[model samples]
Target: MNYAKEARDLDFAYKVRHALNESAENLPVATLDRLASARAIALSRKKQEAPAVALAFRGILAGNTGLSFQGPTSWLGKFGVVLPLLVLVMGLFGIYEYEQQQRINDLAEIDVAVLADELPPDAYLDTGFSAFLNKEEE
Candidate 1:
């Protein structure tokens, strides 16, 4: 359905009602004449515009009489819908793996530092050592 056409018609009706309400009292002859002239001018312009716009639409419809979307178009539309979802899942998995690798690398680095420092194995169990490791990380 053409929603814009319906909305434009409704808007014109609303404006007409509002104008009628505002002009409920009798107006002066000059004001009425000026309004009549303005209405005639506007109606003439609308008549000129309506035919051209209508014929333009008719011409477009006539030209594209055979154009249609089906078969491959339907397949492509489905692929378009699924491709983004597949890409999103793969991207998330890749990010997850990257973060996991980074965490592993961090732990390995901490292990290597402790080995290099030749700390006693007892130091690993000490609560203070945990704080020392965190401070070093900072």
Candidate 2:
């Protein structure tokens, strides 16, 4: 991960490419023209097939053309980011509310059971009562 070494390597590669390009000019005129044509064709094909989302970024330089969203595309992009976070917060809130309701329902059921039984009210406070309720629930 040495950036200096990478920069030096890149510079060396560029020089090598320059030298090769210079040597390539010495090739036959027909060969050079064919090579240029092939390069142009390859670049055109690559550009046509490139994904839009991958290029949904600002230009490489200050004002070059790439994907720049406007109107609905811009709104959709912003909404795309916000929608998931909103859903997550709402989902968590719902789960917490559901849990609270369930706890309340369980307590209400216990209260009804204690009221409906024939046992004395004092027996409800006995330690065994809790265990008996657990066994009943199971």
**Reference-based TM-score of each model:** 0.46, 0.41
| Candidate 2 lDDT, 1-138, residue by residue in tens | 699999999999999999998999789999989999999998887745655565543533354433555232465556877889999999999999999999999999998997898997798789998799899999
Judging by lDDT against the true structure, name the best candidate.
2
Model 1: which ten-residue window has the lowest total lDDT?
A: 64-73
Residue runs of model 1 more than 4 Å from their true location after superposition: 1-42, 45-73, 127-138
TM-score of 2: 0.41
lDDT of 1 by residue, 1-138 (tens): 599999999999999999997885568888888988999998887744443433343323344333343222455545877889999999999999999999999999988887888677689999998999899999
lDDT for model 1 comes to 0.78
What's the count of clashing pairs in each model shown?
0, 0
Candidate lDDT values, in order: 0.78, 0.81
Model 1 — TM-score against the truth?
0.46
* Error of model 1, residue 62, in angstroms: 20
